[model samples]
Target: MVTNEQSVAGPAAEQQGFLHQVKSFGRPFWAANVMELIERWAYYGVRAVLSLYIVDAVANGGLEFTHVQKGSIYAAWAMVQSLLPLFTGGYADRYGYKGTVAFSILIKIVGYLLMATQHSYGGFFLGCMLLATGTAVFKPGVQGIIANANLGNKASVAWGIFYAMVNVGGFIGPWAAGYLRMMSWAHVFYANAALVALNFIILLMFKEPERPAFEGKRPSPVTEFVGILFSSVKNVFEPRLAAFLVLFSGYWLMFNQLFDLLPNFIDDWVDTSGTLAWLGKTLGNPTMLQNGLAGGQIQPEWMINIDAGAIVFLMVPIAALFSRMKPIHSIILGILVSTIGIVLSGSTMVGAYCMLGIFIFAIGEMMASPKKLEYLAAIAPKDKMGLYMGYANVPNAIGWGIGSSLGGHMYQTYADKTTLAKAYMADKLHMTPEAIAAIPKNQVMETLAAQLGQTPRQVTEMLFAMHHPEHIWLVFGAIGIASMVGLIAYNAVVTRLPKPATV
Candidate 1:
């Protein structure tokens, strides 16, 4: 029978009427949102700088990793960030959410501390793993506390607020890092350290319902993780949840690009430095000029501008608009609209096109992104909220890892690597790399070819002009359509699965 503890009236209950005792909001809700903001700030701040740090050359204080090496590390980081939660959530249940989150903050402190000093691959990767570990531990537990504390009618609004806070944190984290890194690269990591440190202190004042029976024991994350790995993996596939997870991966693949590839793309293609220079000249303060790189020529922090700016402009209004639709349809509509935007961002050689793409994509993302997890929460079994919510990251990880690998493959193939790069350049100028390479370093290939054996500059121009960038555009479009179609079919089946009676 439900005890007095379950039924007793509280402020949470006061908000609801006689028929419903569910919470609408409480002190715990505010505490949870505050903690979430700090966690996301720390996570995204560090993340925004990591890839750039890895790929930087000696001149730039970086390791100058091959694209493949960088991609592999990025993919691994994404995998760990997503997969680690499976065990960490259980460990938090057994230990205590507060303690677990505190421990996570400590881990992050150590991770960022190591990163600020260690500029090599070993040090960088160790830091990345630790960072992912901390993120994994904190995420589900934070949400878990929010869910448990606001168990009644307030849970929905409580979660919505939590998610909005997450985006707010995400928005601020990268922007702060970008601005700080422009001041000094060390400042980026220092800022992250400061944000995470705040979490450690803030959590001390936060209280939760109860720890599990094993709460006193400090569980080893590794051991606890391994023990539950199979169980959690098996849990999601038990007939009802499999289809959803499968389709959800596609959305993740799209969303992951924001974190994984967009910055780098901006680094190569954007003229932010030029724009900043122009602004500086116009303003008569050259020192005020900035690059697309936080510290250099490109200002990648502005890439976060798309996500932050877009969310601010689009999220609430879209949520209000979509208030009547099924979450699945919202996700579908979002995926389609965002995919078109993503393709437009990458397809055109122009930076303005990509910026517009991010803006449009942001609108789509605001519409769908929140509902993804909200839908999962609604459909999950009552007893397994921690397990399912923890698994919400599965899509994020899936998208990031796959997108990184895909971006690397594309970059290596077309932009930075051998065949596609050469072909793509050739498409621009009616010449192969061999032809370009054969010409003297300073000489224009077409102009020099006219000096050597080529018939005319116009022939090279004809050959180059015929190469189809449009085919490349189609490649991205197909991926988007394929994902949408898959989700449509998968959801067609998943909607029939057994869900909780109340949600």
Candidate 2:
């Protein structure tokens, strides 16, 4: 018999239970999430515009770097960012997380300030290194705090919340950056600096949570760093594990093309007037819309933000559906799906198709990214699972560094709209190459438009027809497909190998 007391107690107990689980996370988990969000915001804001800022002409307040230089800088930055955590994680463990986090913030502030002032390649690269170092110091500390706090049954939910917050910041960072960059590139840097400064203030209130005690006196940071570096080197050559990581690097190579090439691609190739027209018709002539569309096109950063946005909504459902699949199978499927998405996005100049491609790419990313870690954990000896998982960033570092360098050289050769325009002028228009080079890069489009008695958009279309810039897509598509195929071969070879002697 359901008495009044039992009925009232039933729902009340569940409510209390839920609150207890949340409270069990305590102060540190929430604080770490806040820090993660803000840091990602600053990082992505800088990244969203960095490639474009490097390559744009000096007359437009940009650095006017070559494609190779831009690609090298990006690749080097990614390598530093990924590798640092491996070296510095032990320092955070030995020293307190809170102090390490504060120091990292201070370093980042200096880095951003330096970036705002430096325009030369050497100075700018130094600034990027500083920023990467700061970020590397910060990531492990905050992640360590969150991981320690989410022990036991609450781990799954806590990680979910943490990832959601990350995506929130990621989406906003690029969305805001695309607008700020329009005012001036310096403004974007300054804004990111200010956000990092704000996080420093938040860091003041963070209380360090409990972590496992070290068994002995903590080694000096330099010693610890060297030891980790040696271990990383050793891991790369470790039998079947080495082969697995090498294959995994292929996916990241293709995935990174989104950031390394797509912004410049959109700026040069896509006609976003259709998107602008739709917005104008729906919202009417608002100042914000008009200012943002001054070039009669949407900013590339805004287009890229779609990937983050899609991940936020789609990841959970996609992960749930793929939960039953084998790890290797999911990874292979993911690469194929992502490759198709990349081809679709790049093969067209249409705004809608570009967005649709990113959406599909995000779905593929959801399918594979988590499983990469899962696969690593599965093959490890039970006692060494944590150590094996730590090496997961290896593929990202390798892939980004190699892929960006290669992609940049390829872009310079095949797809750079400016270079192709010059070729068209010398070949088809009967103009001297010297005269073409004399024109400012930014003015090339307008000058061509005037020469042909057409709009810049029409000239862009004409160039597409004559030069076949779409061929660049073929190159990128081949890279993605090749990576997918490489993974399949890796799986077959590794499965047949004798299981390694356990560490």
lDDT agreement with native, every candidate: 0.65, 0.78
Judging by TM-score against the true structure, name the best candidate: 2
Clashes of 1: 18
Per-prediction TM-score: 0.76, 0.91
Model 1 scores a C-alpha lDDT of 0.65
Worst 10 residues of 1 by lDDT: 1-10
Query: How does model 1 score by TM-score?
Result: 0.76
**Across residues 1-503, which tens digit of lDDT does each residue of candidate 2 receive?**
00000000011223335557667777778888898889888888888778788899989999988889988887898799877777777787778788888889888888888888899999988888889899989977887887777446666666666777777788789988888988999998898988977776776666777778889877777787788788767765777677777877888887888877888888889888777766776787675457546747788888877888877677668877987788788888998888888878888899879878878887788777777777876677687666677777787888889988888888887788887777777887888878898999899888877877999888888888877766776777787787788888877776776754111
> How badly does each model clash, as a count of residue pairs?
18, 0
Q: Write the per-residue lDDT of candidate 1 for residues 1-503, one digit (tens) a residue.
A: 00000111123334666434323356666777798888777777777766666665444555566566777777888898778776666666766778777888899888888888787778877887888888878876786677668466555455556767777777778777877876766677877888789877777676765644563666577776666887787897855566666666776676666556666656544445445565566787757554422333446656646666667556667767986788778778887887887777766434556677777777777666777666767777789865776667676677678867876666544443123333434665577668755543223433544544564334333333454322333455566667778778867776565553322
Superposed by TM-score, candidate 2 places the C-alpha of residue 394 at a distance from the truth, in angstroms, of 1.0
On the 0 to 100 scale, the lDDT of residue 280 in model 1 is 65
Off by over 4 Å in 2: 1-20, 282-295, 497-503
* lDDT at position 396, candidate 2: 80
Model 2 lDDT, residue 468, Cα:
73
Which portions of model 1 show Cα errors greater than 4 Å?
1-31, 148-152, 206-209, 212-227, 272-298, 377-386, 417-476, 493-503
